[model samples]
Target: MTWLITGGAGYIGAHVARAMTGAGERVVALDDLSTGVPERLPDEIPLITGSTMDADLVKQVFAEHGVTGVVHLAARKQVAESVAQPTRYYRENVGGLATLLEGACEAGIERFVFSSSAAVYGNPDVDLITEDTPCAPVNPYGETKLAGEWLVRAAGQAHGMATVCLRYFNVAGAAAPLLSDTGVFNIVPMVFDRLTRNEAPRIFGDDYPTPDGTCVRDYIHVADLAEAHLAAARRLTRGGAAGDLTVNIGRGEGVSVRELITVIGEVTGDGRAPVVEERRSGDAPRAVASAARAAEVLGWRARRGVREMVESAWQGWQLHHGK
Candidate 1:
């Protein structure tokens, strides 16, 4: 079955496209090219330039490509930006999703896979966050994702479509150098950027309750995350019951900021000590995933470790930045 991957030329989107097509799945990509590099996608996989907010364009792509399933990955993801511009986030993330679902239901599309985030859980005080964990998003970006999930489930129930929401946690690394994330929004890249400038990396908080007084997170490799998407897509394509399946995509392991930075220093051979700063607001002391549901439901697990993530990400940074 041919699947339409929204945001298919972006960093994570490109990885998903490569993994799906490598597994012999027919896939097409739709990207606005705002932050997406069209050259990242294979020439065989058609890259349609448009937005999901455009109902006419969404419908046109669905009909013209004969798309039987959809893997929606297009959305604004910056937490600080979302907080600053809540309306824009709602319009683009939630409103755009509503439009896409309408087109999917109207087209009789039955399979859908949503790209969700662990941010929906906020700063839960649990050791390992499970699928049933309470969602109390501290930022507007997370709020939009939670709302999008609700809309997806509601649309699925009404239209008899199988849907899955994968809440990703701290996505890092790259499947290839070219596919590596160029933006410095994430922690790994943020640290890389500072090091590239011959400056010390800054740790947000060193007074938290966690070991080393830093935030702890579960980092998953981009390639493994892509495989999880393929697994979710295949599960839907196999004709499962018409319902919603939500799971967290993580390694079920926790790595503190200090530990990760030390590994980064080892990888980059620039062991400059990180400067400690005041804890950022809305920072979670720990946000590790249980990862049991993903393994049981999708039969997928993360094979790469923290060192691999840093090494691969550093390689990608050097490739793109000439560092």
Candidate 2:
């Protein structure tokens, strides 16, 4: 079955596309190239340039490619930007999702995998967040993701589509240097950017109520996250009853920010101490995933560790930045 991967040229999307294709799944990519690099995708996979907001394009791709399933990853994602432009986030993330769902339902596509975020849980006080954790997004970006999940589930129930929402934790590392994330919005790349500039990596806050007095997060290698998507897609394709499944894609391990910086230092050989700063608004003290649901549902677990993530991400940073 041919699957349509929206934002297939992006960092995460490209990884997902590659993982799916490597598993011998027929796939096509749709990306707007806003922040996505076309070269990240392989030469063989067909890459369509358009917006999910375009209903005609969505319908055309679905019909022409005979797409039986969809891995929807195309959306605006940036906490600061989303906060600055809430309307744009709603329009692009939520509105685009609505349009795609409409087209998928019309086209009779039964399988869908949505790219969700751990941000939907906001700063929950839980030590290990589960799928059942209450969602209280602190920013518009998270709000959009949560709303997107709702739309996907509602559409699935109404249209008899088997759907999975994979709520991602901190995604780092790469399958390869070329497939590495080019954006610095994430912590790994952000730290890499600072180190390359000979600047001390800035820690947002160091007085959180954690063991190290810093925020703790669960980091998963991008490749593992991609593989999780494949597992979800395959489960849907196996012809189970139409239903909704939401699971966290994480390592089920917590790494404090300070600990991560130390790992980066060890990997990059730059031991410049990080500068502690005021806590960023809405910063969660700790947000680790239980990962039990994913293991039970998808039979998947992260294979790589934090050191591997930093090492792989550092390689990508050097490849792109020539550091």
Candidate 3:
């Protein structure tokens, strides 16, 4: 009963891989090294160097390892980048899933997990977004993710592929150093990186409708989010029915951008604040998860506070960069 985690050597994928392996599950990771690093995974787990978009490679990995389940995490994730390059997002995020689904459905891999994004909600009229929210995505990145989920759903109907889609917001922190550098990727670490160098973190907007006049979002610790994935995997392993199980993996509360800078200051013991800038395109006024369904259905809720999330991230940053 082996499981395959695509993009397992990357940020959140590495954390999920560590948690699953710690629970004594036999796990294998497949990554193309485009954004993944080998050092992020534990020594015992096997990593295949290939893209999930490759039909032959996907089938070969499934057959070679006798995989029972899959956690698909590999995708082009930047919302701004997607806006710039819509075609690449479609090909990799949509086309790749299409190819992988063909192989998984054929190989009888029933249990499947997908790493979706809150971008699917795309600045909903409601302050908080629930699973039932109308998914009117704003960017190509979100569109592709929604499309990927649809493909997986089709597979669930055609074959008995029990699917779970975790709609993610800000997935950050590093429990283990999978990459050599922390600040090279992600918005959270990028801000932290600026602070470490005594530079002002960029606050894209500060005149929003929220309390702090900044964009508000629910940022979940990657560790807590990873556990939710494992629980979904367990449900699938229990011969769960073939249907779509969509859950938002975030705490119910929202944090403003300015508040985040203040929190980072508190966590790092620095009084430095962020530098205000013009609003970044595609940013919403407020984005938070209504995680009731996740807690009720998957028995999962994010327990870590904003402080812990920042502290763990600080610890990871210090560990990686010695600051």
Considering summed lDDT, which 10 consecutive residues are worst modelled in model 2? 234-243
Ranking the candidates on lDDT from highest down gives: 1, 2, 3
TM-score for each of the candidates: 0.99, 0.99, 0.95
Q: In the order shown, what is each candidate's alpha-carbon RMSD?
A: 0.7, 0.8, 1.7
Candidates 1 and 3: which is better by lDDT?
Answer: 1
What overall lDDT goes with each candidate model?
0.95, 0.94, 0.85
Residue 104, candidate 3: how far off, in angstroms?
A: 0.5
Residue 304's C-alpha lDDT in candidate 3? 81
Q: Ten consecutive residues with minimal summed lDDT in candidate 1?
A: 234-243
Tens-place lDDT digits, model 2, residues 1-323: 99999999999999999999999999999999998899988898999999999999999999999999999999999999999999999999999999999999999999999999999999888889999999999999999999999999999999999999999999999989988888889899999999899999999988889898999999999999999999999988886653799999999999999999999999999989999999988898989999999988888999999999999988888999877
Off by over 4 Å in 2: none
* Model 1 CA deviation exceeding 4 Å by range: none
Residue 263, candidate 3: C-alpha displacement in angstroms: 1.3
lDDT of 3: 0.85
